[model samples]
Target chain A: MHSFKAVFKRELKGYFATPIAYVFLVIFLFFAGYLTFRDGFYEIRQADMRAFFSNLPLLFVFMVPSTAMRLWAEERKSGSIEILLTLPVTIPQAVIGKFIAAWCFLGIALVLTFPVPLVVCYLGDPDEGLIISGYIGSFLLAGGFLAVGTFFSALSKNQVISFILSVVACGILVYAGMPTTLDYLSNILPAPAVSVIENMSIQMHFHSLLKGVIEFRDIAYFFILIIGWIAACSIILDERKAS
Target chain B: MISVKELRRTFGPIVAVDDISFDVAKGEVLGFLGPNGAGKTTAMRMLACFLAPDSGTATVCGHDIIAEPVAVRESIGYLAENAPAYGEMTVAGFLNFICDARRIAGKAKKEALDRIVPMCAVGSVYHQTIDTLSKGYRRRVGLAQALIHDPDVLILDEPTDGLDPNQKHEVRLLINKMAKDKCIIVSTHILEEVEEVCTRTIIIASGKILVDSTPALLKEKYHCSLDEVFRKVTRTKKSA
Candidate 1:
């Protein structure tokens, strides 16, 4: 437990010690606001945060990976990984600590977009339950993407390659359940296969959570996704650390 | 405090550490001397619990490397090759992180920092980010973290690799001061370091031990300087 806290604290502080944190925050917030407003927030004329939440799956596909790319890749590149793994901490503790810290960092970014919700509340009465659910879904979606990023980060020593791999992996997860993609696959494949692919899509679970009626299956899907990817990451690091 | 039994490690077809075994009791400073890729770092890494031996096992501070790796790691302080540290962290922040990992908290944490900061001569760069410091300061900071836990075993691979003459002298002096109690294994190619601080020397080549003896006795046996003795043994082994 102490080792986990130490790793978590160091990794969280490390993100801010470099300019990467600031750059990531500024870009993330800017694009978030841009995408929301550009999607015709006024034209929709709704008090809900649909415009904001709708853009997040795509936004997180790129942004969450950026936050996670440096987790292990930078350590490997700089040779600090040798020092870290040699410490008393186990690989699983280190991996989870880093993942949680990155998840919290993304949560902070999500919270920074508070002004949009505040403005929506001031302009009209919005259902608090829907807004809360939207934020929760967004957080889980970011965590899911971050888990994928963590695995890719461990797979490559170069941050650029890690980021690109994460983006590609997350892109598939987001696009797999889209209506267009599903329709295309339905023509070529059987219904059961198409439905399996749809169920595997992260966006499907995320959309269910956004409706403000959280089902056990949706929550379970995110948990399984996050835990499964993190487990794979730990296994990879354990096997490849000596190399 | 360290014992190896036929410890062997191979990377693909190349045998990085080929069936080597040695032991160091308390109060003995063992110097590992070898050329590049001679498995000095690889062997030290296995002892540090950072790498696993392929076909054999070792014990450090009575904890087996493979069976109880975390316990082995807890009892030893390791300075890896190049003395790697988090470049973005300030000297103080980095040390505190190590303290946290070592589970030194509250007053004990303060005491560990107080003692190690001055001993490693890293007080001057306490607030400086590691990347901004010179190679010498970074090396000292690395050494400081390794000593903070004050473990019974110390595995340092190339502890003085990038220091100036004065810094190297100070480091050797520090090792000599600590040599009376700790079981220390220092890997280096510098022969004078063995003479200055090491109680015994082991020359490794092609992942095998070529010679293991006291520095004074090795010199007397070869009837030459320590430098000449090293070259002769390593060269003959390479030819064979």
Candidate 2:
């Protein structure tokens, strides 16, 4: 636990020590706000963050990966992975510590989108429960995508390769949950298989949480996804150590 | 304070560290001399608890590396070749992070920083980001991080590899100053370094120990200069 806190503290500060954090925030906030109010037409719709919640998954497919791409890739590239592994901490502790720090950084970026919610409240009364749920769902979505990104980050030494791989992986999860994609799959595949694919889709679970329902299954799905990816990450690091 | 018994590490079909065994006692500086790809770094990596051996066992400071890696790690300070560090961090920030990772806190942490800054001669560049620092300064910071916790065992891979002549001398002096009461293993290809700082030397080639003895005895036994002896040992191993 002490090692975890140490790793977390350094990693979180690392983001601000460079311009990467600021660049990611500006890009994420701009697109998130623009997509919700301009593309989704928040002014015409009811006073809720429905559009903001809907657009976040797509934005995160690009943004979250950017945040996570350098986590392990840069460490390996610069040879600092040696320093980290040699520290008085297990592989899982370092992995989880870095992951949580990146996840929280993403959470902060998500929170910075508060102006959208404030604007909605000022214009008219909104479903505060739904807005809060949407924020929770967005945070979870970011966590899930960041996990995928972190896993890819561990696989490569080049941040570019890690970024591209994560974007492709997260993109598939998002599209898998789309209704049209399921319709296409349902034509050839059996209902059971199609349903399973839809259930596994990141968008499917995130969309449910956006409805202000916060169902157990949806929450459980995101948790499982994040945990599974991080576990895979530890396995990779262990293999690297052994070889 | 350090012992290795029949340690082996293989990468696919190639063995990197093949059935090597040696013991390093307190107050002794062991020079790990080897040609490139002789598994010197790999051996040090295993000792530092950064890599696991394929077979056999090693212990540092009375703790088994495999059974108690955390204890082994806490008891040793390892400086890898190239001295990699976070480029975005200042020297002081990086040292603080290392201290935190080592679980040093409060007054102890402050004292560790104070002692190491001057010992490393990194005070002038303490606030400079690592990316902006020269190669020598970056290497100094790497050494500083390793020495921060003041571990019982020190494993340095090519400690003076990239430094200029003056910087190299300073690093050797620092290592010499810290040699008392600490078991130090330094891997290097430079033959002069062994005579300069190592009380004992182990020359490795092709993942095998070619010779293990005191530098003066090895020189006397070979009846030649240390450089010639090193070349002859590695060359014969390559042909074999």
- Number of the top candidate by DockQ? 1
Q: What's the alpha carbon RMSD for model 1?
A: 0.8
Give the per-residue lDDT of model 2 (tens digit) for B94-206: 99999999999999999999999999999999999999999899889999999999988999999998899999999898888889879999998888888999999998987
Among these predictions, the greatest lDDT belongs to 1
Worst 10 residues of 1 chain A by lDDT: A234-243
True contacts kept of each: 0.93, 0.89
Tens digits of lDDT, candidate 1, B215-237: 99999999999999999999999
Alpha-carbon error at A16 in model 1, in Å? 1.4
Q: What share of the true interface contacts does candidate 2 keep?
A: 0.89
Instruction: Count clashes in each candidate, considering only residues at least 3 apart in sequence or on different chains.
Output: 0, 0
What's the distance in Å from true for residue B81, model 1? Answer: 0.9
Query: Where's the lowest-lDDT run of ten residues in candidate 2 chain A?
Result: A37-46
Tell me the spans in candidate 1 whose CA falls farther than 4 Å from its real position: none
TM-score of each model, in listed order: 0.99, 0.98
